[model samples]
Target chain A: MKALCWHGKNDIRYDTVPDPEIEHGRDAIIKVSSCAICGSDMHLYDHFIPTMEKGDVVGHEFMGEVMEVGAENKELKVGDRIVVPFTITCGECEQCRRGNFSVCERSNRNKSLADKMFGHAGAGLFGYSHLTGGYAGGQAEYVRVPFADKTHVKVPEGLTDEQVLFLGDIFPTGWQAAAQCDIQPTDTVAIWGAGPVGQFCIRSAVLLGARQVICIDNVPERLSMAEAGGAITINFDSESVLERLQELTHGKGPEKCIDAVGLEAHATRSLDSVYDRVKQAVMLESDRAHVLREMIYVCRPAGVLSIPGVYGGLVDKIPMGALMNKGLTVRTGQTHVKRWTDDLMNRIQEGQIDPSFVITHTVGLDQGPEMYKTFREKQDGCVKVVLKP
Target chain B: MSYSGKTSSSMSQSLGTSDKLARGIGWFSVGMGLFELFAPRTLTHALGMEGKETLVRACGMRQIISGIGALSDNPTPAIWSRVGGDALDIAALTPGLRDENPQKHNVELAMTFVAVTCAADLYCAQALHKRHKYPSSMVYDYSDRSGFYRLVADMHGAASDFEVPANMRAYPPMWAEFTPEKESGLL
Candidate 1:
């Protein structure tokens, strides 16, 4: 099997590794049909989140045909097409009952497939860390899925792999942002970042019935997509976010705001970190939260703040008083892609929305590392790049 | 859940409309009107459904603010990371991290605090000379300080790591203080 492994800072490489096989009752082995580079991969490409291993396969967004299924994976079967949810969970746990599957006590990831899969300590990801449930990611030709029945969603027959590939991550993540925002029909909602997730947040906001969807980003390609979708676009470099948002809202401000941009902080054309002057140099871009602080000022007194962006566990101090004073409602989390994917798929099937609009580039699995680099550096207008292995 | 009482037949009828335009563009207006009428964001905290009152927490995201807000149009003023956020000289504080040292490094706690703060999303962590501002700091903490592990208790219900809600964030010590501002402007 071949995968883009995270060796260290700026050291991601295309390397051949072992193939995958089913190892548990709720496990399955799937041949990769399609996969996409996620924004989070930037963490490794730039070394924002450092790891000790040089061979971590770091992708959670993928979809494919299931070649085999574990004994307990009865709900799913061999030959079934699936959009693999990034996390594994026992559908029967209390957390699962409540839909918090990521922290499922039963989740397991044998990154090396060197142990039990049913319900052992599974905290590594394809290429993340030994702590995140070290399960090899779908970036490879063949990947193992833990809790297969719960993690893999059968891609409804007839849906193209390209159409459903990102449903595993970006599409669902965008939907989660929109869903978590709880936008109303009349309420104006805004999204930060024009990346794939931000684009989806805009589309999903409109699909779910936001009165107005606004997008803030420096990337022209992303802003254009938002413009086509009827979302008002603004380039933060050329304008003031608070001023423009307040003007549009008559000072009452938007009811909902979402941060699709995670820790990666970039200036007009360069990346700036507290560490130094980083322009396209790919330092730990942790300034996205700065925009969140500004969002607090523009939001209506009782507005909702939704964060679909990823954040690491270690961080600086935060403003607690301001948030509490506004009586603001905040919903931030890793998108439970599985919880709402079926609903999103239905939306796609019914033509309520077409998430594939975010797809701007596609390539074979062999080009995974290069595409990932391009996507990470924001080269080639890569809002969302797709890969087929 | 936002339109608590407006269960009008027409609303359900609109929900059933065929055209994407009718379903989205059409219902959009009704949904907005009902949203206005019922103040959906004010209700439905317990709806256990998406797009409810919790949405307001999405403060100041740039994508959401583009061309429509005050700061969206302003050039962000530069703030040194050391000034805005950085290390706290543990030597100066009363119960200095080293003095009251646990096995973990205090600065490391600050790093974890920032990580979870950013990861948690609602909160933007800056340097604090005091710890009281970070009650929810542990909301993103994996530690069992407040049993917030149950916040995102159903981890499967969560998306990827980044999109998890703050409700699931670990609650830090109610009075955790921030690192004192860097002296002489050093990070």
Candidate 2:
């Protein structure tokens, strides 16, 4: 099977690897039809998140048909099409029973190592790093899905791959980000970053009834897309994010804030961004918290801050004083993808939203390497890239 | 597990020609900067300008800064800085090409090397600029991609039928009664 493998920092290769086989009774082999390059995958491509090894298959957003199933896996049989959620859950754990699938205690095979790093091991993630179980990803012709019976979302026959592919990751992630805010009908939601997840956050906030949705980004095409999604766009490169958010909310900061841009915030816009770059270059900080700082400083008192961004390791200079004094509530975690898939899938079926709107590039698996570069650089108006395996 | 250690197919690399060139230039800049910084007297003597050790060291510092910049995620500015540094290098060497200099041939050889490096730097800079910089005139219009089937105004708050999970709620239902309209007696 041909797969995209991570070689080193900024190095992804199209290489031939052996096909996967079922390893457990709940495991199944999926012949992948479509996969995507996610923004969080950029963290691995840039070598930010640790524990990635050479030749590791590098993708998590994929959907396909079951080619083989384990003997005891009664929930699925051959030819059942499904989208594999990025987070692998056992569905019988304490967290899973409580609807916190992202933190299912039994899924991570490397629980000891993760425990050492994160204090408690969360769910095992596909194609993310060893800290998340180091399972092989779905960016190939085939993949081995552990706990497949409970980790997959069955897609109906009418939907195209583009319309349903994101159910595995970004669609549910954006939905979860908005839902975590508990947005009210009269609330104003301000989102940072207009990439794929950010775009979905705008649409989700709008559909859930926020009176105003404002998206902040420096990319012109992304800003335009945000506008199309009913968000008032702010180019942080031109205008002030704080000033504009205040003005848009009539001098009272937004009631909800979302940071969709994670560790690799662009370092050219503000003094804090420059400071973060210097700290990162000097090995003093592991993640840039500029968006986090800006959000803490500008959010209205007692507002909710929902973060869906993938932040790995440490961040310095967070405004703890402001966050405490303002009585803000912060909610952040990996998306419990299964929890929102049923609702989002219904929305897709009912003609409420189409996930394909974010895809701007599609190509063969051979072009996956170059597409990673194009997507990471945000060149050629590349927003989301889908690879047909 | 049917996985094998051997790969049966050829590998496709992520780095392109221009990317490789930029990386090579970055390493070259770093190496040259270190050499000049550590052995400025050697450089000044080789160029027949024996008293300019401090100036040579300053140029080395400039080279190192540009080199680090070139090695960063965005190398366009760093490569351009290299081009500027190349001009300064040529200007500094011109005085060493005087008729009275004993090492005029070495000075000429040094100038030739700098000129070649300058050309390479210019090419890499332009290529990186073209590859990374978004064209100001080419604006992509994605305004039609609302993802909603109906108009946004019609679809706003359509998901009100769904309830926010209890644990994720920001505040209790009683807080919802304190709306600005209600506080102002409009409701």
Candidate 3:
């Protein structure tokens, strides 16, 4: 089996690795067909994520055919094409039982039974780093899925690989982010970071019935995608994001805001000072969307603010009191991939949502490095990049 | 055949006798460390917050001296995001902490160290900085040694970048170094 790996910062290579075989009774080994470069792959490739050693396999989002399944994996079978959820949950942990499957007990491979047994960092992730668990990522030719019965979301036979790849992580994430909001009928929604995840959050919010959808980003193509998704778009570069968000919302601002952007926001890291860190943070954070906060500040005092944006461990200051005082409800977490995969597949099959609408390019797995470079730069119409193995 | 026989490793490795006992002890130590670091409110009933802080402060300096400890760790980019993003409610603070009362921050290695987001970690950082005030950049960082990567994978636009990996398997708790070039796709 061949795997794409991150040798170091800006370093990626395709290397031959071993084929995956059944290791746990609950595990499933999938023969890879397709995988994609993700925003996090950019983080890993660029080295913003920290904690990785050299030659780390650098991907977790993927879908494939089951070549084998452990006896415990009764629900799955050989030859079933499925999307691997990014998490490795046991589906029985307190978190999993509560629909917080991303933090399941069997999720991370690096963690020994001595560790929480499942998760890394906040919980575990595939091929992320040794800290979480040194589990191999899924950008290879075969993947050994832990706790497969809980994590692998089956893709319908008729659907193309491109249509459901996002379901593995992004679709569920976006939908979950939308569900986190207290989206009353006719409520308005504002989203930051018109990146792919942001784009889906925009589309999914509309699908979930927000009266108005507004998106903010500096990228033209992404803003165009938001516009296509029927969202009023804002480019924070030329105008003031705060002014525009306030003006557009008739001073009440949006009823709910989502930070689709995660940690390495769109600030000048290499070109600027350490202060660039602050700028990128705020830039990617789309402070105006904290209108989730402002919704508390400006809404009818009973409005909701939902944040699906991801954050790393041990974050610095968050205003917990204002969130409390405004009588606002703030929701955030890793998406429960298993909870929605079936429904998302059905929706895709029904043509209600083609989660793959965001994809812009498809290339062979051998082109991963260059495609990663292109996609990470958001170039060549690369909102999403999927690689066929 | 065992139920886990469906899992994908042929190595047939299982926990060793010593490994199982060590695992128990490791969990106990981890629990003790968490209690010592996080449960000062409870631990204080037995040992006291003052004692814990003193011990933490002393041990922190030793960790620094021994090259394994640090007085301050780089806040994750997420924490930096929360602090810088106007999303942070500047008003919610322990009185004059946010760039207001310089004295409350004076014994620390720069007042900004107080800016970490989570209250629990802030307390930890505060106790250490209040004592030795070492200039080491990160008190802790994300790191890992046991390597794991899935042989196959998929992702989509709706997904986030950094978080999805944890959904699959345990990862190292340490953070990876940031690559500015790779981030912007310049590389």
- TM-score quality measure for candidate 3: 0.62
> Per-prediction TM-score of chain B?
0.16, 0.75, 0.22
- Winner by TM-score between candidate 3 and candidate 1: 1
**Can you tell me the CAPRI class of model 3?**
incorrect
Stretches > 4 Å off in candidate 2: B1-12, B97-105, B115-137, B172-174, B177-187
- For all predictions in the order shown, the interface RMSD in Å is 23.0, 7.3, 20.2
Residue B130 CA displacement from its true place in model 3, Å: 52
Q: Give model 2's DockQ, 2 decimals.
A: 0.38
TM-score of each prediction: 0.63, 0.92, 0.62
Backbone-clash count (model 2): 0
> What are the per-residue Cα lDDT tens digits for candidate 2 across B120-142?
99999887766545555656789
Indicate the docking level reached by candidate 1.
Answer: incorrect
Residue pairs of candidate 2 with colliding backbone atoms: none
Candidate 2's docking class is acceptable
Lowest summed lDDT window (length 10), candidate 1 chain B: B70-79
Query: How well is each residue in B16-73 modelled by candidate 3, as lDDT tens digits?
Result: 1222323333343244445545554453333222333545443333222322111112
lDDT of 1 by residue, B59-87 (tens): 21221222121111111111112112212
Q: After superposition, how far is residue A216 of candidate 2 from its true place, in Å?
A: 1.2
Give the Cα lDDT of each candidate.
0.59, 0.89, 0.59
Best by DockQ: 2
Q: Which stretches of candidate 1 lie over 4 Å from their true place?
A: A108-126, A268-288, B1-187
